[model samples]
Target: MKKADLEAYRQRLMLLRARLCGDVSALAKSALHGAAEQGGAASSMPIHMAELGSEAFEQEFNLSVMETEEDAISSIDAALRRIEEETFGTCTGCEGTIPKMRLNAIPYAPMCVRCAEQEEAH
Candidate 1:
């Protein structure tokens, strides 16, 4: 990849990493604390059993989203490393040049579409 393009992607990935880090922190706080953190809606005594269930579900959902965001952050980190190594747009699987359209859509993609599909199939 060109030096200028690599720098641009690096900047974008850094911004994404920063944003996702904040998201993960927020999700962790909300998931771990639940209603207690949200304006003291929680009490020493539990509310309704159904509300407890809902809180559990919400915590689980937040944790799930955090995991997804964490994975994306990892990918962004790997992409930044690849950029530093001068292999940003190259497919790690097939060693082909990944298309610009694909890169534009997913700047942190490690492989081309075909390789990605194959990887997913396995």
Candidate 2:
């Protein structure tokens, strides 16, 4: 990759990392506050079976979202490391240059389209 392209990817990756970090922090705080409120309300009031089921479902959904966000953060961190190592935009799976379009779409992607599809096929 050219120096300019690498620098651009670095900047984009940094911005993405910052945004993901902020989002994860906010979601964590919100989840904690929500759980606390729900717990207090449940203790003070006679909650019906349906309400309990719904709250449980909501908590599960939030947990899933947090897990997904955490995975993204991990990917972003790895991509940042790749940039530092001067391997950004190179597919780890195939040792090929990942297309610019794919990089533009997913700056944290570790593999090219072909390798990603093959991995998914397994």
Candidate 3:
């Protein structure tokens, strides 16, 4: 990759990392608060069993979403490390040059399109 393109990718990866971090932090805070509220005296007093079920379902859904966000943050962190190592835009699966378009679409992509497709096929 050209110097300019590499720099751009670095910047993009940094921004993505920042955004994912913020999202993860917000999700954690929301989950904590929700848990605390559910553990309060009113919650302990309890209402309808159906209402309790709904709250449980909502908490599980929020936790699932938080897990997804955490995964994204991990990917972004790896991408940033690759940038620092001067290995950004190189496919890990094939060691080929990853297209700039693909990088733009997914700044944390670790494989080129062909390798990604092949992996999916298997």
Query: Highest lDDT, which number?
Result: 1
Error of 1 at 109 (Å): 0.2
Residues 34-81, model 1: lDDT tens digits: 656544644554568887677778888998999999999999999999
Which wins on lDDT, candidate 1 or candidate 3? 1
Off by over 4 Å in 2: 41-46
- The digit string of per-residue lDDT tens for model 3 on 1-47 reads 78788788888777877887787788788878878887777836448
Q: Of models 1 and 2, which has the larger TM-score?
A: 1
User: Could you tally the backbone clashes for each prediction?
Assistant: 0, 0, 0
Please report, as a residue range, the 10-residue window in candidate 3 with the lowest summed lDDT. Answer: 37-46
Residue-by-residue lDDT tens digits, candidate 2, 1-122: 89898889889988987887888787788778777877685464436988777767876787788789889989988998998899988999999999999999999999999999999999
lDDT of model number 3: 0.84
2 or 3, greater by lDDT = 2
For candidate 2, the 10 contiguous residues with the lowest summed lDDT are: 38-47
lDDT of each: 0.88, 0.86, 0.84
